[model samples]
Structure formats: C-alpha cells, structure tokens
Target: ARRVVATLSIGKRSHFATARVAMEAYAKRVGAEFVVVDSTAHASLARWNATLHSGSNSHFMKLPMLQWFLEHYDQLLFLDDDVLVSPFAPDLFSSVPCEAFGAVYEGYHKQGWHSMHARSFCSLYGLA
Candidate 1:
C-alpha cells in the first residue's frame, strides 16, 4: 500500500486560515493524512535557519520539514495556503511519475506579472 500525505505551511496570515480549513476538509474527504507545519513555530526553530519574519514568503523552514516528511510518506503533496482543492480535483499522486516531484507550472503566457517570479523560483531551485 502506498502511504500519501498532504502537507501545508501555515503562517500568520488571516487569509491563510480560511484556506487551511478548506484544505483540511479536502484531505478528510480524500482520506489522506494532513500535516500542517506551523510556519511561526518552524521559524523559531534555529536549527532550520529560518529568519524570524512575519510574512507569506517566510517558508525557509519548509525544506527541512519536507525532508523529514519524505522519510515517512511514499508521496507528499505540498499545497500553498492560498490553494483551494476542488472536490473534483483528480488524484495528483497517480499522475506524477515515479521518483519525481510534481508542481503546477504557471507560465508567462498565462500570467504575465508572475512570470518573472516563477522564473526566479526556477533559477533559485535549479528547475528545468
């Protein structure tokens, strides 16, 4: 049996709380384990080297926590707090190639303003 987990980083943003609730409900409906990494607490953990900043971009600690989760779960679906999972959404794990990570690509043609941001992310993470 393949064990899968849904992971999210919870920050201090008011809007994120609403998304968290929806994500939790979605996880329950899918019968998947939902893990919330409290970004506030994670930032406080010095071992992770996260700066104590109160913003949505303060996710430096997620890398370590995600690594920890990989040890236990066969697959991990990481969703941002702003992401809303529709009940009709397909099983993402089934579509992902084995031994590979998956992410939605928001291309420049789709959303121009965010293209530079996406490019920066790709460059920083060395993604193709």
Candidate 2:
C-alpha cells in the first residue's frame, strides 16, 4: 500500500464518503485515503482507439483519476490493475531520470506467445 498511499487524493471527499468505513479501515492500516471513481472500459476496439487518441491531447483514459490528480497532485503514479508490486517497489521511482521512463513492451514479434501482434503497456513501473 506504500505505493498507493502517497497518491490517493482528498479532493472528492463526498464521492469517497460511501466507502469511508472500509476506506478508513484501509487508511488506518496503510495510511491512505482512497477517493472513489467510476471506471468503464469501452466496449469496442474502435472506441478504445479513439479514447487513446483523444487522451493524448486532452483528458486521457485516466479520466477521474486524472481529475483527482489535477485537483491534488502534479504527478501521480498510474499502476495497471494486473501488476504485483514487490516490497522494494517504493524505491523504484526514487532514482528515475527525467522525461523518459521504463515500461514492459512486447518486444518485436520474434519473441512470441502465440495469437497476434504483441500488446504492450506499462505496469508496476513508476510514472511521473
């Protein structure tokens, strides 16, 4: 939870109210205050494509989380749901350089696991 603690925002206090009991319990344990938000992945590839395209210019897929960041932080780490951050996670970002960062990508199709073009995205790595 150390990774999540420093990023959770308090701007949307009302929205996070419903989860207060559980959230507070979590906060007490991990020392975080997670604000709630809705996340709805689009149904079609076309929509997802458009969202990514538009996101590059304006508010991206981060949406509500982006809003929370705008209201409370300058830079926030964005972690994909599937990743498992190790105990050493917090130190991962403490030394990263500026502008560029590391990510997990489907290196050329030469390295394959079957069906199609390799899909790549960042997970567990620190984001600035």
Candidate 3:
C-alpha cells in the first residue's frame, strides 16, 4: 500500500525544519514517504487568516491537505510540525484497519469530554 507521513509548515519560517531529520528517519523506518507542504504562499492562506476565528490557519489548511493526501495515498500519518517521532515507535499503519480513520483523541478524559477545544473540534467537522 502507498503510505505517506505528511506535515504542513506555514508562516514566515518552516516549523518542520527542527524535526525533519528525525521524522524522515522515522518515516524511512516505517516504510512510508515523507512530505512537507510549505503553504506560506498559498492563496487560501490569506483568506483563511482573515475569516477563520475558531482555528489557526495551519489547522484549517490540514483539511485540504488531508483531502489531497487521501487521493494519492492508501494511508497517511499526518503529524504537526512540532511532533517528533521516536525511532523505536511501532508502524502505525499496520495497527489501523484499512477502512477506518485513526486519530489520537486527546480531548477526552474519565469524566467524558472536558474541554471547549474538543467541542469546538467536533462542531467544526459536524461530528457533535
């Protein structure tokens, strides 16, 4: 299966630069292609910046990036530029089923959904 590890890097500088070396090594270990989308010059960025009040520009950019990746890849592992993967981490592609979407739900706790962040995220995608 075609698999890719992708991240979006926007703004004046590349946030992915610091973690690129390590992330590329991890992607190689996991047998996936590594890609970075530098969208600082994208036309949609200015519009998104002006209109979006709920999420940051980078977060909104992920929606289109995800759509593009899904069209070209059988599986994709989308990580924030700031995330560094451990060399010893397992191959996540093998763990998830082909037809299902996988994500780490950090907004939930023992008391149930506890933050506005989670609610806003769900509402953003109409999952609420």
Q: For each candidate, what is the lDDT?
A: 0.60, 0.36, 0.70
lDDT of 2 by residue, 1-128 (tens): 23232223224344233323333343345343443333333221233346566665434435544444444533334433223334233333333432335455634544454222112211222211
RMSD of 2: 12.8
Candidate with the greatest TM-score versus the true structure:
3
Better by lDDT, candidate 2 or 1: 1
What TM-score should be assigned to candidate 3?
A: 0.64
Candidate 3 local Cα displacement, residue 1, angstroms: 0.2
Candidate 1 lDDT tens digits, 1-128:
24444455555665555456656766666666777766545422443543444344445766766676677677777787656555467777677854998888844455565445445544543442
Sorting all predicted structures by TM-score, with the top scorer first, yields 3, 1, 2
Assess the local accuracy of residue 118 in candidate 3 as a C-alpha lDDT between 0 and 100: 45
Q: For candidate 3, which ten residues in a row score worst on lDDT?
A: 112-121
- Candidate 3 lDDT, 1-128, residue by residue in tens: 99999877766554355467667977899899998776644542444554466555455656765777787799999888766565567999999966789998555356644344445534643546
Model 2 residue 10 distance off true place after TM-score fit, in angstroms? 20
What shift in Å separates residue 97 of candidate 2 from its native position after superposition? 6.5
Candidate 3: list runs displaced more than 4 Å: 13-15, 40-59, 107-128
Among residues 3 or more apart in sequence or in different chains, the pairs in candidate 2 whose N, CA or C atoms overlap within 3 Å are none
Q: Which prediction has the highest lDDT against the true structure?
A: 3
Comparing 1 with 3 on TM-score, the higher-scoring candidate is 3
